[model samples]
Target chain A: MPNDTLLETRPVPGTDKTTAVAVRTHALSKEFGGRLVLHSLDFRVEPGELVAVVGKSGCGKSTLLRLICGLEKPSSGWVEVGGERLSGLSRHARLMFQDAALLPWKSVKANVVLAAPRNGRRDRAAEDALEHVGLRDRAHEWPSILSGGQRQRVALARALASDADLLLFDEPLGALDALTRLEMQALIERLWLERRFSAILVTHDVEEAVALADRILLMDGGRVTFETVVALERPRDRASAEFTSLKEAILERILGRRS
Target chain B: MATESLSYRSRLINLAGPWLVPLGLLIAWQIFSGSGLIPRRILPSPLEVMQAGFHLTLTGEMPMHLWESFQRAIVGLMIGGSIGFVFGLLNGLVGPANVLFDSSLQMLRNIPHLAMIPLVILWFGIGEPAKLFLIEIGVFFPMYVNTIHGIRSTDPKLIEMGRIYGLSPWQLLITVVLPSALPSVLVGLRYALGIMWVTLIVAETIACTNGIGYMTMNAREFLQTDIVLVGILLYALLGKLADTITRALEAWLLRWNPAYR
Candidate 1:
C-alpha cells in the first residue's frame, strides 16, 4: 500500500502572518465560573490537513472543537480559519456532531439540501450530495425510517452539502458499530481526498486517528499533548506489522505520561 | 408452561367481559320485573326501555334532538379547534411572544371555563357566543401545551445539523421542527375535540331550547325514560362517528409513518 499521510504548515497571506493556516488558536483560554477549562492554548493547522484530535472524555476535546467552530465563545482568545478570523467568516463553516442529527421529518435529499442557497440550484445540488454519500436510492426516505448508518450518511451529506472550506468533527462516528465506523471512515477519507476540505476530527480511538489522520493531535489537560504524523500507507492493512508499529508508538504517546 | 395460551384466553375474556355484564344485567331486570320481584313501573323491563326508544325514533323527535346536538358540536369543534391550532403554533414557535403570553394564559386557564357559564349567560344572554366561548376554552389549553411540548422536545442535534447545512431558521422550523411536532399536536387536537363534545352538552343543558342534552333533561322531568335513553344513545353514536372521521384523517395524513399503519 502507498503511504498516504501528508502534512503541510504553509500559512496564508494577510493578518500579518507569513504562512497559510487553515485553523489557528492564539493563546486561547476558556473558563467556566473561575474553573479554567482551557488555559493559554496555541495551535495552528495548514489548509486541507486532516488533523485528528484525541482525548479522554471530559478533557475539553469537544470544547476545543466548539470554540473553533464558533459555537461557543472563548474566555479570552480567538480562532482563525482559512486566513479569515472566526469573527469574520460567514456561518457556513462549522462542526459535525457525534449524533446522526438528520431532522426526523426531512427526506434524505431535503436534509442534504437544507443549506442550499435559495437562489442556488437546490434540486440538483441536493441530489448530487445524496449521490456523493451513496444515498441516492434512499433520497425520498424520511430520516426516521432510515437505519443508523444511513441516517449518519444523511448527516454527512448535510455537512458537506455546503462544500465549505473548513469542517470540524467531534467524535462523529463514536456512536456507530465498529463495522459501520470503518465504512464511514472510508467514506469521509474519500471525500477528504476528492474535495480537500481542511478537517479536524475529535476521537478517542488511537487506531482510527492513525488510520485516517494526516497528523494526530493528541490532547490532554486541555492542551496538545502529542502530534503524530501517521506514516502508514493508503488502504493501510490493519494486520500489517508496520501499521501496528506506528499505531503502538502513537498509543504509547497518547496513554503514556510526558517526559 | 401454558403462559402463551393464558395470555390469549385472558385477552379474549377481557374483550367479551364488558358486554356480558350489560347483557346479564338486562336479563336479570326483565326476569325480576316479570316475576314481580320488582314492579314494572319502578324497575322497568328491558322491553319497556326498547319500546320507548323505538317510539321516540319513529316519531322523529330523537332525530331532531340529535341533529341539533351534532350541529352545535360540529360548529364548536370547527371554530374552537382551528383557533386553538393557530394560537398554539404561534405560541410554540415565537419564543419572546410566548413568554409574554404565558403568565396571562396560565392565569386564565386556572378559571375553569365551565364555572364561567353564569357570567357567559349574562354577557351573551343564552346565545351562540356563550356556547362557543365555553367550547373554545375547553379546546385551547391541551392544544397549547402539546404544541409547546412538541416544540421544546425537538432534538437539539437536528437543529445543529441544520446549522451545519446552512439552513435558514425558517427552513429549519418548517422542514424539521414542525414535522417532528406533528404527532403530538395531532394528539392535542384529538383531545381538544373530545373536550368540545363534553362542553357542547354542558352548554346545551344550561340554556338551549334544542339539542340532545335539553331533550334528555326534559324527558327526565316527564318520566319519559325511553326518550332519555334514546338521547344518550344518540350522543354516543354521533360522538363515535366524529371520532372515526378524525381517526381516518389521522391515518390518511400519517400513512407514511409506520406507526400509523
Candidate 2:
C-alpha cells in the first residue's frame, strides 16, 4: 500500500516533537437507534498532516469528525488525540462548522478573543489572528453586519486565535459561492501551511479534498473504503495534468469504477 | 452629496411626522373648548390643563406627587424585576426547576394581577407596602415569562459551539445564553413598565392619599377638572417617557442585531 510508503517519504514540517500521532481511532463504530452509521473505522493522522474525509451524504464522514472532536461518542471503540483518550471536548482540539457560527451578539474581535486562552495576551492574539484573515479592519463590526465570507473569515480568526493542536472542519466552506469557496480553500491551505496544525476536513467536494488535504480518505457504508496520499507539491495547480489525474483517481474510487 | 442631503431631510421629516396627529388634536381641542362647545368643567381645554400643571408645579404639589409615584414604581420594578429575572433564568436552565415552577407560575400569571388588589389591600393595608405589592405583581409576570422564553430560545448550535470551544458552564451562560435571551428579556421589561403604570393608577385611585393617582382622585372630589386633566396628562407623559427610555436602552443594548438597524 502507498500509505506506508507516503508516511515514510513525506516530511511533516512543524510537527510537535513530543507527539508524533495527532489523532488515532481504533475500530471506531457508531450506531444510531440500531442502525450502523460508522462501522469499526480505524484511521491515523500524523501531527501537522491535513487529512480530508470525503463520502456521500449519510456515509458517516461527519460522524467521524464529530467523534474525533469529542462532540459525539462511538458505539464501540475509542479515539485518541495527542496520546490521550478524548472523553469530552479537549483544549487540544477545535472544530469549525459549515456555518460561520459566530455569536451574533459579539463583535468580531470579541468572538475570536472569547475562544482564546485566558492569558493576558488574548486581545493581542485575537487581533493578530484577525489580521491574518484580513479582517483587522472589521474587528469592531457585529457578525450580523458581515457578509457570509466575512463571517466565515471571522470564524477562521476565532479558530486561529485558539491554541488548538488539532483542527476539525465540518464542511467549513460548503455554504459559500463558487468564487468565495475557492478563496476560502486557498486561505485554509495557507493557514494550514503556516500553522502546521493537524487537521481533519470533512467535505463533500472531491476537488476541495484534493486541493487542501495531504491525504484523502473516502468513506462508504460507514467504512474507510479508499485512501490516497496526495504527494503533489504545495500550491498545486488545478489545471496541471498531475492534479487532474489524482482527482480523477479519487473520483473513480468513490464511483466504484476501476478505470 | 445631493442624495446624502436629501436622505437627511427625509429622516428629519420622519422624526417630525409622528407628532403631527397629537399636535393637531391639541389645537383642535383648544379651539373647540375656547368656543364653548363642551362644558369647561367636564372637559377642560388643553390650555387650562397646561395652566393647572404650571400652577401645581409652582406650588411643589406636582413634584411631590410625581416623586412619590416614581419612587413606588421604581422600587417595585427593582424588587420584582430581579426576582423574575433570577427565577426565569433558573427555570430555563434547570429542567427540574422548570418542572417544579413553570406551570404553577404560568397559572398565577393568568389571574389578573389587579384582581389581587383586594386581598393585597387587606393584607398590607393602604400603606406604601400595598401599592408596592400591587406594582410588584404587575411587573413580575412579564419579566418572568420573557426571561424563561429568552433563555429557552438560545440557539442549540451556539451552545454546541461554546461547549466545543472548551468553555466552562459559567462562561457559556455569560457568553452565549444571556445575550441570546436579552432581546426577549427587554421586551418583558417594556411590558412590565406598561403594567406598572396601570397598576399604580388603580392602586392610587382605590386607596392611596399620595401620588399622581391620588392627586387626580382628590381633584375629582373638588370638581377641579383642570387639575384632574393635568394629572391625567402627567401620567400619559410619564408612561411615554418610560417607554422612550426603555426603547433607547433596547436600541443601545441590541446594536449588534442587524434587524434593529
Top lDDT prediction, candidate number = 2
Interface RMSD per candidate (angstroms): 2.9, 1.1
Q: In TM-score terms, which candidate is top?
A: 2
What are the runs in model 2 whose C-alpha is more than 4 Å off?
A: A1-21, A255-259, B1-9
TM-score of every candidate's chain A:
0.87, 0.90
Which 10 consecutive positions of candidate 2 chain A have the poorest summed lDDT? A11-20
User: Per-residue lDDT tens digits of candidate 2, residues A34-79?
Assistant: 9999999899999989999998888998889889988898899999
Residue A154 of model 2 has an lDDT of 90
Q: Which tens-of-lDDT digit does each residue in A27-48 have in candidate 1?
A: 8888878878787789777787
Listed in order, the DockQ scores are: 0.37, 0.69
RMSD of 2: 4.0
DockQ of candidate model 2: 0.69
lDDT of 1 at B157: 74
What is model 1's C-alpha RMSD?
6.2
**How far off is residue A107 in model 2, in Å?**
2.2
